[model samples]
Target: MTTSAALTVRVVTSLEEFKGLACEWERLLRTVPGHSFFVTWEWLYYWAKHYLRGNQLKILFVFDDRKRLIGIAPFYLRMTSVYGLISVRELRLLGSETVCSSYLDFIVNEQHKPAVLRGLYEYLFGEARKTWDVLTLSELAAESSTLDLWNELFDEAGKVGEVVGTSCCPVIRLPGDVDTYHAGLGRNRRYTLQRKTKCLQRAGRMEYARITSPREIDAAFESLVSLHQRRWGTRANGGVFADDVSRRFHREVVQVLSERGRVSLDLLTLDGRPIAAIYGFVYGETYYFYLPGFDPTAVPKASPGLLLLHHRIEQAIREGMTTVDLLQGAQPYKLEWSTGRQSLVTVRYYNRHARAVALKLGEGVKQAIKILVR
Candidate 1:
């Protein structure tokens, strides 16, 4: 714990204590600017519940003098082996790389970001420094305020930190109407979309369904998994929903968020047979295009996956959504439809301990070897 005249910081280590902070967490998240579905209580809590077995939670809470919650650093400690030899304790954000979570940061009130961050820094580096060898913060948005603030803090303290580009999230800003959006696309792209739609429609009766009911989520979600696997199973990197744990995690998240009208599980069916499916969410004014699957055997030339995405975009525009977030990928298909992109970065800080220094040296050697080989 750490305190100042206006701010106080406390760490929540137990699962029960973390569970009790749900309401407060949600409230604090809402006060954040551009808060997305990834940071919601449902997403992170369920993620922790499913993936927290081998790790220790180190969630930090910052509060005002009146005991009101002002910020939350959803962190966890994990023991990682360097080259399967040296064991190093890593202090990482809760929703790290495993589940492809993006826009991760400390949930802080805009007004008190500086003070809250200072409080968190004081506790992590001042009081709890020895608990971890390296601090790994990943998937932060390009323009995230935490980036600059933390960099400043590190510079002021003469601590070396590395920031590297991790991935890109392409986004499509929607207009008020679908026609207006179509008009903005390039001629060749627009022609391709039209031709695909017409080709698919000529084959059979096409229908788009958005599944949100809790009772219907299980079936819809499973359909998404099946199509997803069929599409990606033969590739070098298989489907994300291939494992039982990933399936269960997403199913629960979709089901819970469905009750709150936050889930959008869409399927494009031809003659009542599902061909393409998209598992996404509707948060704020944005439609998050999280995952998609399409039957390669079903109208392959017509491109069911692309057609399904077009239908979702049309629906989003009609329903007044401002953006369609193709989360955490720079695939050709995603870039074709994207009007803009959000850059994501990973920040790493190493302590001066021998273990951390060894780890840093190991990383440098690996980079040097890669460069020489190239």
Candidate 2:
């Protein structure tokens, strides 16, 4: 534990303690500016429930003199080996790795950002310095205030850190009306959407439905999984839902968020049979387009995937969403629809320990080799 002025910092390590924090956790999150769905309690908690088998929780909490929660660093520790030899302990953000969670950060009330960040820095690097060898914070939005503040702190402390560009998240800034949004699209895209919708309608009776009832979640989720697997079957890597654990994690997320009316699971059907599905979340004023699956064999010429996406965007516009986020990819389809892109980066900090020094040197050598090969 550590204290600075009117702030106190501490850690929560057990699952029960984490569970008890749901109310306070959400209260604090609401105060954060431009926070994403990935940082919500339901998302991170379910992720931890399914993915915490080999890792240890190190969630940090900050409070004011009045005992009000002010900040959260949802972190976990993992043991990683270098070259199958030396062991290194890494502190990582909880909703990372295989989940593809974007816009991750330390959830802090904007008013207490500096003080809370100072307390966190002191606690992590001062009192708890010996516990971790490296800190790896990934999937941070390039413009996130948390990213800027941490960069300042690391620079002041003279810590050995590197900020590396990781991925691009394409986004569409929506206008007030659906017709205006349609007008802004490129000519070719507008043509494709119109042609595809007409062709699909000509084929059969078409319907679009958003799954909201708890009873409908399981069946719709299974359909999503089947379509996702079928779409990726010919590719080298299998779909994300191929594993049972991942499926369970997402299922729990959708089930919990659905109660709050935040989950958006839409299916497009033809003649009473499902042809395409889009799974996403509605958080704040943005609609996150997280995943999509469509039958490649069913009316391939009609492009069911594209048509479903068009419908979702139209729905978002009508529902007062200001943005449509195609999270964590620069795929051609995403860029074609995007009006802008948010850059994501990974920040790595290595303490001056023997293991950390060796790892840093190894990383430098790898970079050198890559440059030479290029």
Candidate 3:
């Protein structure tokens, strides 16, 4: 909303301006057909507050002639070394590998794609060309139209981009009812799911609940982490709670999002004792499975983890969520449950500078060596 020109793109650097755009941002995000919760101000604002060390926020906004906000790009600038060899000034997305934001895309009104893309490029590569040497974005869904836009723009600009890594994100399409969803699954899988549900039933009263109350947030999150640790032991910490920073971000962000009715921390209990849990975010009628944890000591016959997933699905369907994004993984379980797989990719676009070319080449060589080794 803070801008000097009528038809120009604006760079939002101050936290005040970021906060001011909350209403418009959410409105624009909803206008977009397919978007993720990561683009939400609440999610990226806290991310910046916590893990944006040594980096400068460079969020971009594009407005129409009527001063209507149309597009938004959450970006940051930092100096990074490629494999600790070549140092390059990088302009990257708000979320990175460390943050585990499974998916990302700009919140752009489809009508203004051209203007937004052009204005953004002019700002980054023309007005402030020297500010950055390379542009990197990761975990973009392969089918994401944003990827296509970038590819088209970079192609038009005669710049070569590289695909550094790719992962499969499977998602389940929710049905009108849980029974219909179960019926849609393969007969074998349906039987397994039914058996698991019955097994849990035999273990006294089974209960499924979502934790959203402010008072219950802390205890629920602790139970989530504790059960996660118990299930994976040290591996849990390594995977999700890899460091104190990630832990701190989740602890605070979950509470913040839950307050807004955006978080869905599904908890499953067997006879009043927590057995399995999954951390999810509900945004725009889509459920994102961010993390999951279960008590490993639970009865194997019940398959507490799978049962929790089933319960979560039932809840999502009843709540009218259109899809359940399993994030990034090709696990057999995910494969069985997913209606289809979305490919997430990492992209790097180097400017026409010596350091940029060197860094790109160096990364290509490293990736090639890794492939060879594999």
Candidate 4:
């Protein structure tokens, strides 16, 4: 472990420092256990450097006594229309839109999350208490220990901290081989699995292929893009694979993750040609369902995407993964396999102004629509 005498905490408020810190942050991330490509220096840097045009993205870093990076918290100071239509400031991590981003929260060294969060809140809330109205975070993973800490801190602060919103995330527990998992799903789901596997087998030699090395990453990426484009065409949200940024990010993520042997880029192929691919991460005992695509032309009969998922789950069971997390989604199929749902909540910490109230109203509107649909 690195020494702590030279340890220092800095909040990079300027773009120049932000850029420099990102370089260091990424370098350290590669060494951190379970570091994800999404939180990689390049991924976050590219997004912040591009989308943050005039948007103040404040990046905070914690250096050990040796001046070596140990933690990072990527956040932004921005103006939204909710706070009385005024430019009331707040700090938040860069994440997907409510309609899109699956989850949110900062990436810190697993060992340093507690320290980083404490330092981050101190600086953000301490300095901006007079100028900013809120300090909000969204889509935090329910299983994360940081969420538990946040709850404790909120209680200690004696300030208003609310769950605000909650949503379900489904997961599959994989034990032993695919056959064992199939048997565990019980009569109905097991029957469907048997039928689907048979149908898929009749269509072609259904084989599950995983791109496990950096050497295979390029070809696997091309296969993923080709199938994704063919599957979604113009209707699928272009943000995923339609643009250079996203495509490049995915490639880099796969390469990095494959290097660690923690990424599962599973492909369903017929004969020798690829038809469907599911890109996800297998960390510890959890398999994260990140992204997937298939050839639309081969749908109905092939059902490549669904078949690939089936195979992936089976593989996970064989690998002894305890959970196959669907991440965030309301997909009916996810419910079909998931026996339990992990509830997630969103919260915002405020210093002043009516921003909290406006946010609550927006939440109410969202809830009303959800209730109406249900």
Candidate 5:
């Protein structure tokens, strides 16, 4: 049966083909409800160029009858291990996991999302005949509209899927100004901010600035990454800057996004020295609290990192932002300031292949061991 006669699918198999979708990619982002700079071509392409490292890339596109793009599934197949098994072709979303591209999904234009998803699945299982052992999609918001739509589609097909909870993303619904925002905060956060601000002011000359110029981006972002590494220092399974590849990838993305006004790399300076920084991004009316760093030597009273966070929240409100996404972490600070939460899940689908069967069995055995231990 024709999945959707009005829609046609295209598979991009190489880097050159992927680059050609730049114009169409930007146009499609404008048609979606959830605005995220991390998912944009600027971010994804840079990530692919640096981090992909010879993985086979498979990009699927869904177009309407007029050949206008309606959806994009930027995916790649890579080798992974399961239960001592090696060389498994796992399909996953582009710019996912290692890049920390929050809220990843198929970029489906809302107007034709249903048809696009259905068309995409048809292409995956039908015409293309993908022999992928398992498909893994991660960092999708718990409330993701795409998750809901595809879940329904998969359920109808009687396919078994697994959704593992990953992270808790807290969000704040802004109310115009700093004063109002402070009023809505929990007592602890309210007092913490007030006390910390006074201490920070007394400490030295504190200056908070958001840099967006391409000329200034490189230097400022480099400093931000440095602070982040120093503060983390081989903790939390190693910071994002632990690997040189991720650092370079971010440098490229920041430079591009800063020019387009999609990024706000905030640096908080004290006594003419950089003490803290926050990597922030904007898409539509939403502000993403992407990454952060602070001087380890700074006193707790100054709360340099906390202060920058507070300032950015206020700045976002003043900018007329409707929501502040704290990205994919559930730290106590995020809980204190956040009024709501979003969960990211990993959806794994298996094919009727030897590799897939081995993975499913490995998972079953692993689950049994975990249960026995508990």
Candidate 6:
């Protein structure tokens, strides 16, 4: 049975080949609901040139019978570990770390999802028959057409795909301005926010600022790293600001996104010192929250983390944004401010080989552990 009925799938190997189609690819993504600025061509291009190097980062495009591009999925051949097992894995080029990114999915044009997925799956699996061992994608948003397309393709192809894990990406729906938001929270949450803001106000001088230019980019980034380390140093988890590689990756993304008006660096200062920082991207009427860290030692009474979030919520409303995506974390605090939630799933598509049997066993064990824990 022919999997691709009418679509043409093309593999782009050279950077030039990918760059030529970048404009159309980005345009097609804008048609998707809640499409992110993080997936923009500028951001991806910078990452490819600086970080990806000579890796087989396959940038694929699916076209309709009319030769119009309908979808894109930027994947790279790399190594990933799952439950003490390591193998060559095809992952979204955007997420190299099993760390902090909350969103990961293929770009599916609004008009063609299942069809695009079928073409992509057919191409990947057919190639995998001779090439790779496993294809994995983590942090796929449950609300996206990405999951729907995967489900459709697997059902039609009669292939087995397993869900490895699930997590929540929280989002706060902005109804009105800051006061309105505070009014909507639970009594304790409301009081906490009020008390925190008031405390900060009383302590010397407090200010909020957004950094969005190439010139101001350097200092803003340094402040983020310093604050992040100070906050998470106790737990010994370096957070996003831990090392040079992660910091470089972030700065590169920001520089690319800032030029396109998609990035913002929100800073909170107290007594002339930067106390908290947030790196977020704005796209399609929503603020996609990314890395945020605060000075845990400074003004513990002010609750700097919560203070930063409160300011961002108000900022969102002031900017007329419809929502603020808190990103993927099962943190209890996400529920306090979030009015809505989205589920993110980890996907494992098995190859028909010895690897498949191994993965099946691993999946069974994982499921058993999850059930026992529950």
Question: Among these predicted structures, which one has the highest lDDT?
Answer: 2
Candidate 3 lDDT, 1-374, residue by residue in tens: 32333456778887777778788788888788767788788888888878887788888878878877888888988888877887888888887747678677777867777667767776777777788888888888787777788888887866677787888888998888877987787699778878888888887788888898877888889889888877776663465765688789999998988888888788889899889999988888899988899987887788888988977888889999999999877889889788998888888877766667667566566533432233
Quantify how close model 1 is to the true structure by its C-alpha RMSD in Å: 3.8
**Worst 10 contiguous positions by lDDT, candidate 5:** 365-374
How many residue pairs collide in each prediction? 0, 0, 0, 4, 0, 0
Model 1 residue 267 lDDT? 99
For model 5, residues 50-137, the per-residue Cα lDDT tens digits are: 8788787888887788777788888988888776655677899988858667888888866787788888777776766555877888
lDDT of 4 by residue, 1-374 (tens): 11223345666776666666655776776656644334555446656654565668676677766666677777777766664564556666665332234445576657777766666556555654565666667666667676878767656765555565667778776666766666677898667767877877887777789888889877987888888787775775753677776675567767766877767778988777888988788776777888788887763565678878877887777777878888777689888878677766677765534554455456575533332233
Question: What TM-score goes with each of the models?
Answer: 0.95, 0.95, 0.89, 0.74, 0.92, 0.86
- Which digits, one per residue and each the tens of the lDDT, describe model 1 over residues 290-344? 9999999998878999888988999999889999999998999899889999999
Over the full model, what C-alpha lDDT does candidate 3 score relative to the true structure?
Answer: 0.80
Global lDDT scores for all candidate models: 0.86, 0.87, 0.80, 0.67, 0.81, 0.74
- What TM-score would candidate 3 get against the native? 0.89
Error of 5 at 230 (Å): 1.4
Model 6: per-residue Cα lDDT over 235-289, one tens digit each: 7665765666667777777776777788888899997789999988888789988
Q: How many clashes does the backbone of model 3 have?
A: 0
Clashes of 2: 0
What TM-score would candidate 1 get against the native? 0.95
After superposition on all C-alphas, the RMSD of every candidate to the true structure, in Å, is: 3.8, 3.6, 4.5, 6.5, 3.9, 4.6
lDDT of 6 at 103: 65
Residue runs of model 3 more than 4 Å from their true location after superposition: 1-6, 83-85, 201-205, 363-374
Candidate 2 lDDT trough over 10 residues, lowest sum = 365-374
